[model samples]
Target: MTLLIRFLRLILGTGVFVLVFGGVELTQPETSTRWAVLGGTLGVLLLLHVWSSPRRGTADDPHPARMSDGKPQSGRAKRQGARPSELAAALAACRSAFASVALFSGVLNVLMLAGSLYMLEVYDRVLPSRSVPTLIGLSVLVAILYAGQGVLDFIRGRILVRIGGALDEALGARVYSSVLKLPLKVGRNGDSMQPVRDLDSVRAFLSGTGPTALFDLPWLPLYLAIIFMFHVLLGLTALVGAIVLVLLTVYAERLTRKPVTSGTQAGIVRNGLTTTGNRNAEVIAALGMGGRMAKRWEEANRDYLAEQRSVSDIAGGFGAVSKVLRMLLQSAMLGVGAWLVIEQQATAGIIITASILSGRALAPVDLVIANWKGFLTARQGWQRLTKVLTVVPADAEPMAMPAPSRHIFMQGVSIAAPGTQRLLVQDASFALEAGHAVGIIGQSGSGKSTLVRALVGAWLPAAGRVRLDGADLDQWSPEDRGRFVGYLPQDVELFAGTVAENIARFEPDADPALVIAAAKTAGAHDLIVGFRDGYETQIGELGEAVSAGQRQRIALARALYRDPFLVVLDEPNSNLDAEGEQALFQAIVSVRQRGGIVALVAHRPSALGTVDFILAMNQGRVQAFGLKDEVLAKLFPRPQPAVAAMPRLRLATEEPAPPLGAAAAGE
Candidate 1:
């Protein structure tokens, strides 16, 4: 659409030239010749206008009112609108590319004006004999200049494209850098699924149209100014047309603001859906709830579709209105031009030139409108991205590194999510020597995981402090803190790569021997060897192809690879079967034996039976803390009695209460 509009602009410029000469001839004393020129020029102008007008039936305009069925029409697709730093970079590139073009273009416009004056002198018989050689030379020079312009324009376009590519890289880099430092909760924002959809939209604003707007910004204004110089009144009229068109573009942009916001919110919903689906996929499959899950997915998807329709409708309506306004302006200019000629305030030549220049002046504004919405949208995306960029990570600091110490201690630690009264963990205090194993156990939502997370400095306690050696955890630099602490969440995730690669995710140049040693210590080496490719075998998405036990082991291996002084494991043995659980328990003991402080959450008594100490929790508060056996005895003195079996009547009364499986399945 942008290219077509530009092409029309050039053709319109040519039409202006022809009309100027033709109208001048029409003012001559000879009626026969004057009528012929006027007729030919008017016919050509009419044909060109019709040819240039956008068609209603094309794919570009598949549905005048909407993009698809049940979707609302886009207000104006053209109005579809970048990052601030990115926009700045694009603007710089554009200015550089257009400098030479603008300089030469000005020269060419002057030459064109001179040539028109010379022709007028000849028509009025002021010049007795115009030299043909001089005219021919000027023609050749102008042709060559224009040809050079064509080449320059192509080069400029290519340069702009290259600049756009660079800008995209910069934008992506900025996002990645910010993401790496973001708090896990913030980085995990938009739900995991949202990144799949919203990231692409972000890229579009970055790579596709963001830089293009910056490129056209220079040319559009220059062209408009040149048209304005041809005739003051016509210029003003064209300027007004441009302004009105710009206003329409602004109105359309305003209309889309709400929809764009809705779209972003919808993206959040999709993220939630994705997280929900991922967290529940196994349950969905095992329970045969595929149809229900599909229905839920469908509902969320439909909501997204509806939001998209709303956005498109706003854009399409804007486009329709803009087109109508442009046409109206075009007609008005020509009609007023004719009137001026009839009143003798302007010559026929002047009238034709003014009309042509009017189109030229208004054309860039038209093109601007087409890209305005895209530019605006890009800006909004930038704003969203900028919000991410501005969020200071919890661990960002002034670069002073805390002194390394083997002592890990928490003093009156109390943690909670922001703006919430629900405590995640409260007034938890403990001290661990350089080498020790501590087991934390609680039912779900008892804050066992939160305690470990806080210990590792993943969660900032609202009150109290985590101290390493003598220095506070917040006093440590990010690198120092990361190097000292390692963590494993309940559910482990593995990227698509070799076992060795997954273990050394952050250490690109990690030794294969080191990776093997870590895997062995984490008890993942045997499972890795069982694969056909051994350690080189690729893991599928989230390591879904691997058993939960394997995933947990791999996570342990990753933590082992870090070789931190403190390892915080949230349910390291939760996914493991009996044998796998034994292996993980051994790994925990081995880490402590090797002088690493190990803190693991476990509910199963057997899994944590060997730990040095037990921290029993209930409802975010510590219930008991002492030697493992002592704490266990205090928490549960004896097992609760089993439910008494109902008496069974002889002769198999009630059909033996059905099989347990049958009864459960039936329920």
Candidate 2:
């Protein structure tokens, strides 16, 4: 199959090359050669359509997945072949659409000759014969052809738009998945939204006139070939103009690449700042730091605008030059054609036809120059998206595993912060069976939160394994693992949705009963019911409509939803009052009672009252892990007393002999 495809490609490519070069020969009469060229062009387009069309595998082709070398592929190799990178897969999916677009472009370009041909007929045929009916028939035929051109052009545009939509449909989810995973792999860089914007840019460019300009560019050679049939001098003049415009397009690309790239970077920075500011609007406003923040944003915006202006100036300048040069070259074609006419080398009709053909040949170049900025943006977006998708490949779905109802185990688990080499938790090993709850205690900056993050699969271990029921955590897909693990980070954030949706983790088909159950377990049922809309109350972004403690309670409810097997909460009670703290204690106890394991990181002693065990950590290392009271005893041992030598020690320390005179002098 591979050999057959290559052979066909070679044959079609050779035919196209031959037709293109052979069309340049002007020895044949214009009428015969034009018909031949037109026929050959259509044939070439048909061949191209055949060559570019996607081939599907069939049952009869047992070795359809074989390599180009004709070897049977291994299972792994077959899998890899079947699963291409996200971007490549998306483009491959659009192959049929693109081929259709190409065919439409060819037809449109052919119809573009209607105007030149009409002028030629009016000047050479109709005027010389003085036939009104012939002219009328010619006009009607040209009108029909023009109408067909318009229809094809509209269809091409629609196809391009759908192609953009198709690409987005195929890759949008994968790109969003990459966006979600990027922060975990690279830490929060404040530019997480750039990948999404890049994808939008590519889609927008595809839907716009930029791609139409690109499609029309390939037909420039065909136009020049037609002009060559008019006269040799006219052909050379048009070719020279095409070459000059091509050079200008290249120069424009070179000149604007840097500015476009810089502008994109600056825009990302400015947007990042805006997002950050908006997220922390309350802090900025309360601290009276709005002016400073605005100043910073203004600086970033100014840089972005400057770079954008530079890109615009380059594209605009080159576009103007290309337009003027095309006009000049068209006039030059007419002047040259007139000279040929004066020399009796060509007819007068040839002058107007050649002039029109030359202008048509250069139109794509001018359009490209005009849309150069968008082209650059789309190209750069493609490059960036490729990098991002490559860096974070799609997650492989693992075999289904049973729900974890046993112990959670960590074996020599050393964890480093994402995107950094420094280990935050070193060689941490522990285990907790069902019906067990462990409280992690440590000083500030210790590895408690980091360890909990790893336990809940928010971060992977640098070296070692986190297992549930003897199976590695990675053996389960994210969705499956999430079903077995619940995590509440130190900073609680809720999405913009109804209260019930947030409590249900935004599950489209979530059970209302389970949502209420989880909320009740978190002791937030009454609080929610007190709201005007109760469970259906709308929550603003980041749960800004709710108090901090309320957000924490809702997050806890989310974590508790569906009653995951392993629950890890970091600083869960930091914002909870005494009542909220009591509710947290009850929630932990409930998890234990239900045979679920829990790992709670807390600084407050009250938060640990219900835990069965304690894991003490210090300076990125586990200090102790045992029964709660035993570990606490080791961490804070009772102070020893010096009972026998107390009198002598007191006598040496007491300097009460400074009498009244010394007291008066001091006074």
Candidate 3:
């Protein structure tokens, strides 16, 4: 539509131009006027094409598609908002810069002909006439042409720099968001920014002469044709050399393909391990396990280096061969031209010119062989970015149902960690209504965290369904679901920001009153106030400045910021002291009393004090589930009366009833 509008606007302007300027021309010439006007118009249109080609850049589109929601989207949905046009727009300035470079390159290549032409003129014209004036004039003109080439070269380089910066600005944030959103359970490589580094490789190649070499390649035939114009024998010889070099380029690539692939894979693994290991520096040093870890990383690193070195060796050999072949080709062309001249078929001037042009013709091919590694890296990076960014989940529109009341129903919702086939939660089913407090009791690794993740739509269930308020959880858009659902993960991480900022979930313009309320509700208000700046106190990344208990409280406060209708807590009190635990217990019960469903994953019995019902999980399957007491009894079973002791007071003891209030309370 934009292009159509632009074309229409151009046509309208042209009509106006005809009305304004054609009054005399139309009357004067039936033959030449229109053509003359068209000639001028063609030049104008070409200028416009160069000037306004890309539509807009960061300056104009204050709202680019790749730059998503004001707040961090945190996951794959970060890529959801990115439209193809946005990426193109982000690169528009760079592409326009390249286009200009291409234009200058054309002029530069033409100027390259100045040296050849000057040589020809010296042998064919200046020397024959013995005209020093003509020689001086030619020298001045050649010097000007060389200077022009140098200027164009400098300008093109500046354009590429601008392009690189623009591309980085456009894509960096999206890449960061996508990385953060990626499921934690993804493969080892997932945690590393290999793709991001791949982006860097792409930008580095683009900023270099790789692009210029590509642009120069197509003009090879032009140089070769000029050689043919001089003498058929010289041209044919040069053409054969060119073909041989082309074949050699292909052969080198083929020979080096396996090593490149192996090296890249090994490098990703090595980098991933190194990044993961470094983040645990304290642990590695304290445990004294650095030696073993270093050995493992060294093995991977060694494989990568070996493969890369092998590729480099092969490529280096091919490069040397190309250089030698090029020199031989130049010498061979000169010899062929000399032979032609001896036969009185060519001139001395033609020999040198042909030799030079032949070298020029082979330059791009040599360049390809020389920079093959960077080219391959850029190619892989491009492919990786395309594959990753093209991925998008089905855009499910949010259900317009009444605000969720936290009636959750789970049926056979099996789950497996991302990038793994083993099931973490197998056919787990449960149902809970609003105003209910449910506890999930499980041993370590018994799928508590995995289940909640699936429940919150972070990772999909491998089978069956999870429903909220009678609608499939997948039916609701993440944004819509997020408005009412809150989750506190097992590993609580607070973003680097002020206490109030964390409590408000980093929502800009967060109401002070609401922030205070949330903090108070989670028992975090007093703790935050104890800091130097109260709500304004800045927290370090991952809340490293605070105690573990404080971090959990802050995270819990973040969860309750909006008074969500449903809350899922995966061992929320794991880092909390007894006081904090009591606060968490009260918060869960209070939320339940207010018609919010709370699913608390508990390991300690004390934390389950107020749960209305309990689900006991063992071996990824639900062992028992019911009223808290009923489930516990089934998990433990009834102790049988001893038959030998049945004779005396044992029978009376068996008949004796426990205290009614305490037994019924199930506390």
Candidate 4:
């Protein structure tokens, strides 16, 4: 498509050039200067086209990076070892589209001369000669040029929109992946969604008029040159206006940069508050804290608006000043042209022509000033996206390894919370073989959930290794690891989908039989069947439609789906009642019976009934690990009767002093 657009532009440019060249030759037979000017302009445009053209990748390149949609990397990108950021690579992929837009802009800017030339000919040629046919001819030619200009402009706009779309296609999934993984790397913060919003801002700027002004900026020199051909004074006037506008643009940047940054920070805070408030709506309402939350949000929003208003005022002020200055400059060119004509140094036609040319020259500057905020936003977004992609580099596709069924081992594993150095589990060395079910028991914050998370690769060990069948967890790709490792987090959160779909992990081609089988194994089949749509029942967002126990049971079904080799359940029965607890117990026994390893993190002793082994943790350290009865006895030894007799003897001795009636009389 890019090539086709380029070819069509080339053909149109050639045809227009031939027509204009012939017309100029016929109209001014003695002047070779016009020919030189036309040739130079074409040469400059061709040079820009070549400079903007897309580069192709080659096998011999030292550093290679994937382009949008997995296209070959551009050989021109010579970054060594480190791959180019995803945003950069994606933009490089759209270089052809950009080149095409540039070419179209060149053609359209050249055609912008139609109005000036038509005015010049009407004043200097047709009116003086009273030639009606000549006037008609000039109008026809200008009309054709204007039509081509409009077509090229439309094509340029379309290409820019597609470039934005292509960029989104290239980086959307990667950005979303970063959004998910960034918390694990940098910890969850207010700006978790910033990357995605940044991407949207970039795409929006590309698809808007901001880039059109940018593309037309380079042609300012061309217009100024034409005005110089008319008269240096007129050209100098336009140049001064352009310089002032450029200065205004720079000033706007300096003035708004801090405010834009502040506004973005404020927006992040506001959005975070909104998200938190929405997530805990019930608590907020029940506690009558809605007004307070709203107040906080309002304060954040007010800050954001203040910053935004500051930026807008600066941009609007500069835009208005530039627009007025540009108009005044055009009028100044006319005044200068009229004086030159009066002095018999130039023709009457030069008056109108120079004014139009000068205005055309300054139009881009005016546009850029007006859209300065958008330009800054796009630039900032680009910088942010580059940083994020750098921070969380793309995952390398590791070589496939066979599924593990032997043992899960943690050799001196130390686990820390994401984005923090505080170790939650330290030197926790342990191993569980196939068919072994270990219940991870601990007090609150003893790192039972943290340990199980490491076992399932949700959190990586800061020190030592987590190995599955002798292979480190990092050796397996996430997709492959997920197939063998099943994890139920302490909080059971389900996505919005049908019960069967959730059980099947939303696989596009999930089998109904397998889904039902997994549900039955998790002991959620009967409960699910009781729903209005049975397995087809739609679970609302976060499984809000179901009760807490139901959500937990459904999550258990999801974790137990496909009979994963390593199943890690973190407080899996937290919300389960007696019946749900029984089902969970049976599910653990079922996993063990199937030769699968189970690591269940639970506070309730009843939930550990089916486990063969117990792993006790305390203060981020493994307290004990052995048979369930042995570990339990060690952790909670039975009280001796001799020790219990002391308190009873003291109580009996004190109570023997008085009966109820004697106590009342004494009182």
Candidate 5:
């Protein structure tokens, strides 16, 4: 638009100059003057047509797509917004966009300069020609020069439009890829929606108005130089006009920027509400709290409206200033041109050409100043993005993985946070035969889950090494170790996809029959089939639509889908009702029957009734390890009743009930 508008003005100004000056030749009544007047008028009309022609930019619309439920889909619906690397990636894209525009601008200015020189030659030499052939030839050469300038201008405009889109794609892909690599902890941190909002801001900065503004920065000086070379006075006038306009724009922007800042703050508050709204959407709907949420939304809307008004007010001021400046500059340029003509210092054609070039020179600068807000916005966003690249991941020494096996050993094992002596679990020494089922029982926060995490290599033991089949776990490759062990954390997370997809997460190519079999064994087959699409039905984010028991079943199915050698379930029975708990017990039995090792953390003895061995934890220490009855007796000493005297079982008497809650929240 900028390029086209300036070029049109160049055409109109040139034609007006020739038409007005050619009238002077008619008054002279000389044959030479009459021929010059007719020749110049024809040349000016050709230039006008060439300059005024349309120069359209690339016009592809934005259509961002994202992957969901392991399937590609289109929308702005992104998971866990941009990561730290994503921000840096956006800046890199912006830098590339800027460079491309600079190149285009250079090409444009060179062609424009060539056109100016050609016009200067025609005015000084060709207009004086008496021969018709000479006039015709000169006119043809000028037409070719204008045509070349027209083509260059068209290309420049197209490049700007296309570059923005290319930059957007590059930035989006990098940010999305970075988000995939971001540590789960950081991506899942904050109010659960922080990642989405932050990433969106980064995306807007890199792919929005900001990159376009950056691209214009290089064109400002190039255009300014083109005008300055025409005539020093005209160049100085345009430069001064630019300075004054810029100052006025800045004042206007400052007024607008404050409201935008307030709007951004209000946006943050609205985002917070939206996040909270999503988290409690169910409760809100069920409890009929629509009125309350609506009221909050109304407040946010009101605040946004006020900010909008402030922005509009400032924009109005800028518009008024722009119109006044345009009028003033136009008056000044004509006045100067008329003065120069009267003084016999310059020809009418030179004065006219300078006037046309002046507007073109100042055009890009106006654009740059108008878009200054975008640059600042992108900069702020860029800094935030840079911070992501510097975020500290959890410190862990890289070590070779152990040999692949289900057998796990903990020799003098202890797990503790850094800079603290408070061991969550300590002095835990145990060994399990390949394919053996071991049950862990303890009070709340007695390191039951911690022990499971250490066993699965999520966290390394602070004081001891874990061994797999006599090889140190640290000696094995992470991938190799992972292949041998499957971990199911306490709170199960499911992607918004089919039951089959969730179950086959580790193996996208796994047979659907196998997935169903695994789901059946996990006790989720019946419930999944009840959905409208059965295994193909969509599950909302985190499986919010499903019951906690169903989520656990799906998670179990997922763990089993890969048929890992060792399955570690922490508090598997926490969310399950009686039937679900029984199903879990049966699932454990089935695993053991199949010669697979199963490890579980449970607080209730009844929950571990199907397990072969029990490991009791107390205050970060292993109190006992043996068969269930033997370990239970040691952990909670009591008199044995007649019914509890069986070798495989024991009844409690004169013993307090376990104080710990029945839960084993795992990682």
Candidate 6:
């Protein structure tokens, strides 16, 4: 399994990084003939990578599985809306670029031989023979090789930049949506930003010099082999040095990984706390808890700093060891080569070339040790983002569907808070026909909000079905359904846009007629037109500069703007005064006039007065459902029924629950 994954990674762009492995063959005194063979092998690997496709190693995958005979086998069909996983496929676009870069890296490694070869020729042939013509020829060829290497290096860096950008462009939206959908409890450290932040880390590592150093790593072996060709003793000396460096690299990772990981976790917590503090800055200031908050932040930051210090200590130790070993290894190789010369087993030229090769062999190892922290971060980031990448919907294109009518249905629907095991709502059922407004009254935690979320298809039901007419709610394309469904949450959230845009729900090309009608229906038209820029006046994210009542009125206008088939308003008039209450009642009547179904989660009588039906909830179940008057009378008696004949309905006497109404007495 490990080998398969490694091979897959190579095919996806790690190929360029592995090109350095064949570079040892370049330092030989031979001509361009030997270079061709090693280059040809990498070329073949590139070709194989280009032609390959990833396959799932399981039988139950929705994508077609492969048979033992190497032919395709049919599996269960995939969901109609979901597509096969394309995380790898999207990344594969960079493979060809990496292949080209690999070839360039290999050439550049070969060009490095120009320096050693120039010295070898001058020492062996130029000085003794006094050949000016040969000297000039070698100098020109060496210059050309160096120039080519420089040009290739520049091109390779530019290609890496483009690869990083392409990866972001290919997956940015998908990853962002995935992160948004993730519940807060799903985060590793309760920081919901991990998945998206992980992608950024991955991109940074790919585009940074870390990958370049890693690619050079494979060339160490080639360099070692060349030194061995010079003399057995020098080769063995360099080989031993390489082994020590590799072991040191492994040891450094082992020593520092835990501390670095702890530091990262601490950092995530610090950042999350900082964000929370900023978000509630007003509350903190009003409550005068600044000192306490600062102390808490300092404590979290101190833990992070301590962990980072431990990692730094380990890194410093490894770096010092790696530097000393590498320098000694070079000096030792020279001594070994010199002994061979004294014994008449090698030439003086062999001593210098062998020393240079040995030094180059250890350079990459030391470089990796230097950048080990960043490399470890990139690895962890990849692991953190892998699952989300696989699960993110690569294809969100909607299917063609006719518009939905106002008839709605819910049959035994159940719902739970995301990432929690207990259900917040269960066995709840209701139906609404056109030209009717339904009201849901419940205590604060009575699942009214959860039911509304399920109705809008934002939360999928765990047990039952929510449908529009005969079609399952999940079957409808979100884009198509969005046109017919307008939902206003209890908080009355708004984006940064003009008043008109907010009312039009930030649609770029909003219909003027619909926008005007909705604003008028919600009693916001006059208020907006009176603003400095009228409908064009800017609104803050939290509707800053606008009163809470104004924001609620604006949200109500947004919900009513599209003349949707279904409208859901959660506590629409919660922050409104008597006039705003009248406006909300009028808006509910407007939805009824348009032959639409409206579901209102409300606590105030003004918000519930216009509704034709009432559903009262307790805990997670529907305790009463009937005409508004019938449910109200059942919950609250005409005058307090006689002791023996009292109503048996469960009624919430807490804040926000509607008290007994006069309509209940006559009914």
What local distance difference test score does each model get? 0.62, 0.82, 0.75, 0.81, 0.63, 0.74
Give the alpha carbon lDDT tens digit for every residue of 1-667 in model 5.
4565456445534543543454344323342353354345445544543454333222221222223543222222234443335433333333433444444445444344434444544565556654455445445544644664575456445555554454455445544444443433242322333334455555455444444444544555655665565466766777788788778876776676677667656765776677778878979999999899989978997897888677766676676677678668867876787787798766666665665666655555455555555544454445544554355332345575544555667899988743355678888999877656889887887888888888887766779888777777656556666666777887678888767888887454778888888787788888789988898877778887688888888888887765676789998878888888877888888877777788898866677788878988888889888887787776778977676565544467555545455333321
**Which of the predicted structures, 2 or 5, would earn the higher TM-score when compared with the native?**
2
Candidate 1 lDDT over 7-123, as tens digits, reads 634644554454444434423344224333433543454355346433431212322232344332232332442223433433333332334233323333333333333333333
Q: What are the per-residue Cα lDDT tens digits for candidate 3 across 171-216?
A: 7776665565554436345226776877788788877877788888
Whole-model alpha-carbon lDDT for candidate 3: 0.75
Off by more than 4 A, model 6 = 1-85, 184-189, 390-398, 640-667
- lDDT by residue (tens digit), candidate 6, 1-667: 3354344334423323222332332232342333344435545644553454233321112122334753323232122422344445444545555655565566556557657756765776667768786667556555645554565577667766666666676667878877766652242334567777777887887777777777788878788777777777888999999999999999999998899789888888888788788868889999998999999999999999999889888988999999999889888977887888889998777788777878787888888998888888877877667776654444355567676775898999999876666899999998888999889998989999999988998777778999888688756677677788989898777888888888887777998888999899899998889889888888976687688898888888888877888999998887999888888888888889989999999887767779989999999999998898989989987896567876666658744535468557656
Q: Regarding TM-score, does 2 or 3 come out ahead?
A: 2
Cα RMSDs, all models = 14.6, 8.0, 10.8, 5.6, 12.9, 12.2
- Residues 1-667, model 4: lDDT tens digits: 4565466456556645654465554344422244335545654665565565543211112122454655535445544633456677677756656766777787788878768877877888778878786677667656756766776677777777777877787789999999988988878889578899999999999888989999999989988888887778888888898898888888888999999888888989989998889889989999999999999999999999999999899999988888888788878887888899889888988898888888788788888888789888888889989988988888889999999989988899998998899999999988888999998888898988888888888787899999999999999998889998888998888999898889889988898888888888888999999998999999988888999999999999989888899999998888988888888888888898889999988888788888889999999999999999999999899998664444434654464667789889999
**Clashing residue pairs, backbone N/CA/C < 3 A, model 4:** none
Off by over 4 Å in 3: 1-104, 158-174, 184-191, 390-402, 536-538, 637-667
Which one wins on lDDT? Answer: 2
Q: Summarize candidate 2's per-residue lDDT along 17-100 as a digit string, tens digits.
A: 433444334122543355346546646665765666444221112222345775334344456766445565566555556766
By lDDT, highest first, what's the ranking? 2, 4, 3, 6, 5, 1
TM-score of each: 0.72, 0.87, 0.80, 0.90, 0.66, 0.82
Q: How many backbone clashes does candidate 4 have?
A: 0
Model 2: residue 57 alpha-carbon error in angstroms: 18
Quote the RMSD, in angstroms, for model 5: 12.9
